[model samples]
Target: MAGSQGPLVLGPMLRYIGETDATVWVETAEPGVVTVKADGREWRAPTFSVMGHHYALVVVDGLAPGDELPYAVRFGDVVVWPLADSRFPPPRIRTIDRSRPTRLLFGSCRTSVPHDREGNSSNGVDALRALALALADGEEAWPDVVAFLGDQVYADATSEAMRDFIAERRDITQPPGEEIKDYEEYAHLYGLAWSDEAIRWLLSTLPSCMIFDDHDIRDDWNTSWTWQEEINQTSWWHERLMGGLSAYWVYQHLGNLPPAELARDEVYAQVLAAGSGDGAEGSGIDLTEPVFDLSRRVDRHPEVYRWSYRRELGDCRLVVVDSRAARVLDPDRRSMLDPDEMAWLDEQLTGDVEHLFIGTSLPFLLPPGLHDFEAIDEVLAQGAHGRLVAAAAERARQTIDLEHWAAFNEGFAEVFDMVIDVARGNRGRAPSTVLFLSGDVHNSYVAEVTDAAARHGAQSRIVQAVCSPIRNPMPRVVRVLMSAFARSLVRPMHFIAARSRRVPDPAFPWLVTDGPWFDNCLAEATIQGPDVAIVWRGGEVRDGDDLHPVLTTVGAVRIPGGLDDGARAGESAADGRPTVAR
Candidate 1:
């Protein structure tokens, strides 16, 4: 607890039940009476403490879908919304029309750094920021939902505001002091992360869904057995992990899920089911006790719970996977997802939606060059050349821990098969496009998975569209080097892996036929008539104060027949695209 402040944040906004009835969750700068009003109605929810942070989950339920409603928050009769540096206006209620398909603007990985002083000098337009600006300027169309894929904040990379808050509460001069290593520090980190002006307003107005990535806890989270081994040995690791997971429930996770799911969620069910009477507003079921126990239980028995969640819009279903925390870290058998999680994903993919969107924080497909490098590393890990293999394996384990899908071969293969099965029409009616929407690589690009045997009427093309580092950008040199290396070595690396017995060949051989280029971009995909059109728009810095955001059209692909076409017609269009033949 630092000095008491007044402005409360009503955000991490989620629109459910057609955007008319939105669920707004908030944290008070100070414990006080928090009330919300939407559609001329007011609801009061009690705020409670968790390691010094006070939070309230208010469901602004009951409103007309497809209509915009204005809402505001009050703390003890005084308006305390949009704390300071207000970059945007108050939230306007909006609704979704299920009869027609919707445009979903999604991306992840944002750091809480101050925007450039001139504002125009900001190197790249943040995806979220750009959306806000667009809405403010009355852009033509708005995305129905903004899926914030992952890493909304970096717990390890504490900002100055977070550092100041921590220092004020406890003497960091002591060993292991300044850095956040416990529940208390995590509480403050959440405050700084979500308390931004533009993002808060955007979240409040637009419907949002979210998942977590490594920086949400720590960098290179759950890449391999060796990486886990190293992290577990650190003295502060347990507290850090526990704090991160616990705070995640209170701050982020609880709001993203629907009311029905929350009621069924084991831990959250307890929170919702608990009630305390006796004229005490802040007094309710103690969130800390169950939260701590649940975090520990999930950590010890990772299989007992699941962080993955799914949402369906019209005929489309979006499955978001939790790559970290729910990992099987055995050296002999490793996977990003446990068996239970994989099974859930398998079931979700068995459908014929107009569009099937699989959202993962990590990209399912990496650059061809990077993919080859990983295969080479895996071969060495399997005893390629005595100690050289062993040493190379160790370094590879650490370096690769932070990125790529190759590290989690088993789980990756499971998803691969599931996706391939859907594309091949093993499922009911294959979707127009099995679109994989992802972010984590810090750069954005689009890759399509075409079936080689599809020309013979076997299967359709599956596309992967990535929008990453919504706010973060890699250095120019690093970007150039990565592209150069991927282009030069991808083929040779794939050859070595395919020839070696250590790494099994994938069911569908994927090639980066379009691009391995880097750009701060946002991808937009919409189903128009029978065809699904996808376009990648890269952001360009403007020359003057009022420069329009430039969106470079990188690529677009169309899936011929829409969702209604049965397996017979699906086979023809599915195999119509040319395979990336080596």
Candidate 2:
């Protein structure tokens, strides 16, 4: 058994790549020492057990900056990765280069389904797959890192494959039937989501970071106090919450940390100390109790664990905030972030960097009309109208997903103030751009804060860049409704919002300058010195090939640095649509 190399169950994913070190995460079929050999150097880490799943994060250090080298994964004496029949080239790890500008690929809300004609027709092409194929074929420039904003897997809205797995395990008619109920189910769900060969290879080569959104736990996960009360009543909510968080720790959150921070993590330390013994069955440590206990503590008191992290790439700072679990749900003091998380975010929003990227799963700036509508819903739900109206408002809020930053008025205002201050050089030397990178509305757009408002004609360019649905496409009717809200209804909504005594005037007015494009797409943001350029791309099938789709540019825009009002807000076009400011 010790000599036998077990099949890799999930990953050989490259995560947390830094200037001179990188970590590789993997899941093995059995408890074993995972080895990574790159550039004539080898590093090994023993697998730790999470429930019955065996995994390891091998930290490779002492490499020089800008070193790009092919790597291989090994279990015992046998090679388990870069499979003999694989079509892609050997996966390589590229260390950070301080001189080069930062290029980041980002998007959210992907559903795992067949990549055939039927799935493509229903969900549009898989933009991520297209990116991977392009990179594998040496057709596009490689991003330094990829940030998946949210919904890496939909625990609430299961696909047919997930539902079938659920049916196999439990009664389909029962409560939480199709929804994932425990760690095992979540593990299976992740397997389905990441097992695609092309994507697997992409993950193996590309450094990636992720944060969870509503669907990772459930839809409208912590939308309000009422939402919590309702969900807490369900028989399976405890197990589901515990399971979801534990799995998130094992799968997504673990990779977000660099070696130093990861070493300081209490849960990781405990797991490492506990140790999974050998590749033999029944020899591994069972982490269910400790892991679930940690999850329960987190769910009960979100302040106990923070999911947010900040990374400095060259002169750019990328702060990925956990807008979900760390929420303050008291209706009287509703906030997207709790006090501690907000304070942490405050520290991260400084302007010393040339570009500051604030990544939240939910968009910080919504379309103007939708922002007003959501704000109105929040106010009404808090009894701005009356008790009867408030009750109805709460129901409507959950039903239609009016739970973005706008719904948490206080938090939204505070963060907006922070951005304004940073843009105005109050925090540090004002960065050239203070940008919010987000997803989760099933559409994509670029919104710039109106210069005449609270922008105060600041030196920095403040913009919201949104991309969503790396695969899942919104229905046509919903697309039409979104377009109308994004463009046509802005004036009316603003007028209505101005009349609401309970809703304070927005810190600034903004407009969607580029898109409300409802494509299954991804967005790439490149920061060169002080200037920032954004491009959205989607996959398009050619020659009746369902699996091999080519990436087509959907939109492109640039935010000029050291802005003068007359300085051109750059423009670009794709699919015969204007995608930037005039």
What's the TM for model 1?
A: 0.87
Model number with the top lDDT: 2
TM-scores, one per candidate: 0.87, 0.94
What's the C-alpha lDDT at position 242 in model 2? 91
Report clashes for each candidate as comma-separated counts.
Answer: 1, 0
Residue-wise C-alpha lDDT for candidate 1, range 340-444, written one tens digit per residue: 887888888865677788888888877666665665675566466677776778676666443367766777788887887786678977676677888888777
Candidate 2, lDDT over the whole model: 0.85
Q: Candidate 2 lDDT, tens digit per residue, 438-540?
A: 9999999988776522236566778899999898999889999889878888888878988878876687666787888988998999986777888889999
Worst 10 residues of 2 by lDDT: 573-582
Off by over 4 Å in 2: 1-6, 274-283, 452-457, 564-582
Model 1 stretches with alpha carbons more than 4 Å out: 1-12, 15-21, 30-34, 76-89, 117-125, 163-179, 276-285, 382-388, 400-403, 452-460, 535-579
Model 1 poorest 10 in a row by lDDT:
563-572
